[model samples]
Target: MAPCVTEWVTSCTNLILSATALHSSYRLFKDHRAPSVGLFLLGLSAALCIVHPSGSYLTSIQKEAEWAGEVLAPALVSFDFLWLSEDHNTAHILLCGSCLLLGLCDWLSADALTVMTRCLGLSSLSCCLTVCLFAGNALGALSGVALSLPLLVAPKVGAITFAPLISPAAAEGLVKWLLKGSMAVGCWASTRALSMFLLDVTDRCNMGI
Candidate 1:
């Protein structure tokens, strides 16, 4: 298949998977008495996953590097001013702060999901799957955010400031690889979580529990 076709296929698949996961998560929340804050965090995490760029179109547009850069420049500038800066220390501080914030989110999500699973009296497999899903989502979100900073934070400035750095193409390739890894982790987690949840539901129905 053509590259564009392949990219579209992948993007569609991701969208479907993310949607399914989000639905399952919402249902779980509805069935349990989770903290309001937990619900908000999980909802936000799911939203981020849904809205994050897939870069599928890059395959076609990368051919016009200059044009792509021109189109992306304004957005990049805004991202830098808002989240990154020329000062090395400031950039590091921002990156660390973002990571810390997301880390807290991940911890809260995992704890909430764990509590819900236990409250439901799910089997060990079901509990494990839920935890795996949380871990996967957390890792994926964090990694995606980390990869995005370097890509968007004053690419030209970073190139000059950080000596012995890789070329732009190399950096882009690295980011793409990391992005794929994150997606893989998410896919694995979501599939397991959904399967286990369904299985639990079936068991409950059969046993009238």
Candidate 2:
């Protein structure tokens, strides 16, 4: 029961982290100058899955004879034993799976937006507005990640301790701050660009120059 509870907590935490990473990636991609940052974050998020324990250790447990005697031994036994481990492997799986899905959504959303703009022959103002709106959403989502950055990086500190001279928590905090700043800058720039585009359109119509 204690193990199950731990798994639930870990799973929930991973879900939050994965969601934030995905949101950050989406917003970063919307910024023409920041797509590289978004891609970096997306890659980082995927790398988290690699660090996640695969739960293979759960299989090391000795099974009861009756459990092993089942007709569909592999399926039934494995399913029943999934949540019994201390490492919360089930939670890791859920976290990785959610990240995968969110990454897909991010990609699809960007692709769809690009296709729509091209197909509709959107004007510069329209394109600017679309990007601004998307960047705003990304900024909102990134705030969640920034708020939860500590929790997200806590589990990795031990592994990072083996390295020389760097404190994992401090490093993570710096990275989080940098990412937040970058996103904020992108949002501000997009808003400014949109305003300029609107002003240009208005000038073109009014001056006939």
Each candidate's TM vs. the true structure? 0.27, 0.26
Q: Pick by lDDT: which candidate is best?
A: 1
Q: Could you tell me which 10 consecutive residues in candidate 1 have the lowest summed lDDT? A: 69-78
Q: In order, what is each prediction's RMSD in angstroms?
A: 16.9, 19.9
What lDDT would candidate 1 get against the real structure? 0.35
Q: Which regions in candidate 2 have their CA more than 4 angstroms from the true location?
A: 1-163
Top TM-score hit: 1
Q: For model 2, how many clashes?
A: 0
lDDT of 1 by residue, 1-209 (tens): 35565455545544553454344345444432221122233333333433335585743333233222222221221222222112344334433433343344345575553343232222222322333354343432332232223223333332443335665544544444344344334334433333444455567679986
Report the Cα lDDT for residue 114, model 2: 38
Candidate 1 residues lying further than 4 Å off, grouped into runs, are 1-162
Clashing pairs in 2: none
Q: State each model's CA lDDT, in order.
A: 0.35, 0.34
